[model samples]
Target: MAYKYSIGHLTYTFNDLKTLLARATPFRSGDALAGVAATTYQEHVAAQIALADVHLDVFLREALVPYEQDEVTRLIIDSHDAAAFKPIGHFTVGQFRDWLLSDACDTAVLKSLANGITPEMAAAVSKLMRNQELIAAAKKCEVLTSFRNTIGLSGRLSTRLQPNHPTDDPAGISASIIDGILYGSGDAVIGINPAGDSPANTRRLLEMIDNFRRQFAIPTQSCVLCHVTTTLDLIEKHAPVDLTFQSIAGTQSANASFGISLSLLEEAYQATLSLNRGTIGNNVMYFETGQGSALSANAHYGIDQQTCETRAYAVARKFNPLLVNSVVGFIGPEYLYNGKQIIRAALEDHFCAKLLGLPMGMDVCYTNHAEADQDDMDTLITLLGVSGCTFIMGVPGADDVMLNYQSTSFHDALYLRRTLGLRPAPEFEAWLVQQGIMDRQGNQLPDAGTYTRLLGGIGQ
Candidate 1:
């Protein structure tokens, strides 16, 4: 169906829901590159205005990517809860945005509405929201998940100690891990992205981290960001696997590009469950997504990148993941052109994922080529911290040697925690205080001897 709205003397017509959504999206380079972006600023605003009057139920009836062609679309349509959607069934997109910002949408109400809200609905409303509105609405919805430690707790911010090494050297990776732990990071998980995907090398990396975790009796999890099939092989070999990791995308074809299927993911989830590695809780999946993945893989099927990115959350939520993050700026300038675009995409991803009931985190990062810097990252991290993000990356000095990008440093996590009065996960916080790395008041203790002891204890 064609949707039309007038701006001054011009009448803008969107031929379909997908076109409407693409045109209404805030200016990002990926859509422009894909030839789906609005051609002019007036057309963009007109599309937004036309979209606001679209009834919430219109999304339920229309699948942006046809239900027959995509499994992701099928999953979304099949899993929707009509009964839960009944309360706000009558609201238009604009009214839904208003309802999200109103006092009526508390945490409990948001939780009840999770099953009812489709990814498209979440994406649609997000396009109409400002940055602060996205933050405010997301702050009210709490998504808690756990493996060895609880994440997404109120007043708690967690960090993924990403100790990635270019050569997959155990010594260098171990040093980064030690650095992160002393800074009160790694409560989310000490995940490594190995240089190679060899199963033997993956096993070595996993065993190395697991041994260190056990030696210190750390209350956290360990993951080597390898393929799901390799991790599944390691699980069969009884390697110490705490969480199954995968880089997922929104469309079936896009995930196929990553060599993963819904059934394969389910199989991995079940295989990891058989080990029973978690102590606190059993949410055992970790997923990473980015905006331009589908378009990059040539599988977006004409939908905008942001909406396709939001659909990936449906895939994540189905697994009850411990950590699900959007590596927002990692896709570079093509998807998110600059610091402003990166920041907007990060906030939108967090809000849409949280609303869909996933424990959302952000890899507030950018490639060297992107028009962004640590200053932009600082702004993004502080905003996410205030929005109650589940976690952020804690790389060494805001740089990933293996991934070749600028991410949040361990000190950046500390800055967010200290500035916003947020603490680490409860279990990991206790361990930090017990080790004398931090004080009872959540301040890092300035003790050189304590640091010396931690460094000395690394190998033993």
Candidate 2:
């Protein structure tokens, strides 16, 4: 394209990620640093190609073929749980989808390396390798720094994202699709997604979070699930006084259970193995938040699955989760309707933080309403204000994303990146044009000045 954002600063968009990676260092053969995984190379590739709904071949042609396996092998390892280093029993569908969802090497290349790899598997594997140099290029959290002129950094940052779909490529494999995407240079993120069925997961994940050392852009998964006052107090105690927990959840999967009350769930969570607070090298996390899933007690939020889960997540982060998700329905400005109970539940977590992330942008209803677009955005702003959801996103598929960050979509399985944007769309062309995203010509970005002025100090 147009390369609009590249002319100056604020060029943080999905396209940039692809371009940067394309120009990034290439991987070398047999690089052990290419992220430790539970599955073998062959098994990993087979699963990547067989994932459901993924356009694997198309992704390979577009993003991978230009690079070599050695270049590709240097992938981001989302979690460093010992389980990741363990072996997989078989390439089942679940394993395949999970592996594919990761931003790692292609399944095709993985299969090619195996002795008895099949033709079908080879076709699926494609060419696989890590820009092994990329791994070395990354300056760990200790060294990652942020540039004042440009947003990309080498250390930690407040950046966040909410992706709309899974990448159809292996790059998606190494990166935790559904978790946080640590963008700025030396940085990492922390959050939970209710997937840890083990007691020690919190410990294991935190360790990995601390281990990702490199320079330049960094985005990775870091989480902790906690809800009850006691659990919160414990974390606080460990913090002010200093403490840490080493997770053994991956090793304690069988003990995880679905419960009915908050106390029971809390007990179950507390029961998980952990290092005493103050222990060093504890990075990856799966904190305790009263589970929001049906089997657990915290699921009363009003919206559908997306908001309900995200709402609880909001509380786990002490109420103002920097990033979150929501589900609202709209056609345009004059016609916006939301689920009230959901808003209440999410807002209830306001004490969570100074800023929170709302990976919102799901329309439960969409029709040809004239004022639908504006109504949707305005209402969304109002809802977010009340809900205290901070990090915003400008989703591409969003029928209504006035700007990128107040914010949100997703299916990549975890939270990742904060898309700072204010672009135009045409699904509701007439309505949006009236709102200023478009001009009389009905084409091209309105203008750099107009786009910036639109958010008007709401959130820069």
Candidate 3:
């Protein structure tokens, strides 16, 4: 079999794909396919397969996948894996063709096939889908995995207490966390990215979070965002570690930038699971990823940023992370360019990650140099809310005092809950009512004396 290939047009011979199609039951030239010939349809499917293979290949290396520049009407493919994603090898060309040509292809049945296929197949078929179509597929996905009811499930969004500080001071960190809690955030987990990567700093952060948990009886988990090795070290030292944290990338070299590998991540997963430190259960991993991290680390192989980002989610899924957030706009403008690009990338990341069977969230933010604003975040938050996003970053006043950037703030969490009629996780909501910040019916109360004292203590 002769095979042809191209870079400009990005074509591949796909002889195997052709053979796969030829062996499938022939499609009668009926009204379903209309005038589409069997051989022609075979070539079309083969071309799509080839394209997806090439696209995923590039995505694996470059950490970015470019959409076709020319305007084209795309098919709206759905993902079926409501609970979890199935491997791509489970389906054959015949099943894919049948779903692609079906009249009722827009429903859950086809969407399952769309998501159940391998990343390569999904990438290929996704080329035929519009952005809105992708979002629709994600909406049908319902992931219920959670530690202390932080993530998974639908109708509720969660928030992480990113209480990072310049000096890794316990007081500063606790103050930030207290503020987040006072504003009705941090139901997701009290996860922190420490200023220093040393085990001492990591241990101090973990101990602070644990102390606060004991002091306030906050029903949540904790993690210090450091290398998996550093976290493992802290775990060995008997530092309170609720969740193991790591920054994962799509490719080997990029992941190596943080000195991580698939084996190492698995080791961390096993080590954390052995701790049994979770308030809810033993799913104790928290991973953070961004679209440009691979490229920044000089690890991208010309793959598109979105694909690279999704590949990172594959790593996260391997460990069943309690929380996996794509810090979308936090990586800056070099990869995504501006707010328009950021919004598209944010939705694309959420849609792809969710379909891949990982609990997904967006850190709806942008660096100072990026072309974005709070209103841009507002747009993204609303979209993610409707799409059933797992959670969002909740800092103080949309600004990470330690990180020196603006992101979705605790106030934004309230806006999303009030506007979308979404509530916090069940345990967090109950905590709110107990503190008199909200009623049992989920209404905000006018007078909450604890809130006043909290504000006075924080001097806000």
- Best-matching candidate per TM-score: 1
> If scored against the real structure, what TM-score would every candidate get?
0.98, 0.26, 0.77
Off by over 4 Å in 3: 1-116, 446-448, 452-460
Task: Summarize candidate 2's per-residue lDDT along 243-355 as a digit string, tens digits.
Answer: 11111110011112221232333443343224332122222222222112311222221112221232233222221122233223321212122333223222322211111
Tell me the whole-model lDDT of each prediction, alpha carbons only: 0.93, 0.25, 0.66
Model 1: ten consecutive residues of lowest lDDT: 451-460
**Tens-digit per-residue lDDT, 1-460, candidate 3:** 3334454664435343322222121222111122222255545554544443342222222212222320000101122242433433433433443344445544355435434433434434444445565567667666656666656657888888787788888778778887777777787887887788888777877776777666556677777888889888877888888888888887667888878887888888898889876666667888888877766787655444454566676677678788888888877776666777787777777776766667788889988988788888898888888888988988888888777778888888888888888888888788787877777655666665876655454432
RMSD of each: 1.1, 24.5, 10.1
Over 302-391, each residue of candidate 1 has an lDDT whose tens digit, in order, gives: 999999999999999889999999999999898899999999999999999999999999999999899998889989998999999999
State model 3's lDDT.
0.66
Which 10 consecutive positions of candidate 3 have the poorest summed lDDT? Answer: 69-78
lDDT of 1: 0.93
Q: After superposition, how far is residue 320 of candidate 1 from its true place, in Å?
A: 0.4
Clashing pairs in 1: none
Model 1 stretches astray by more than 4 angstroms: 448-453
| Candidates sorted on lDDT, descending | 1, 3, 2
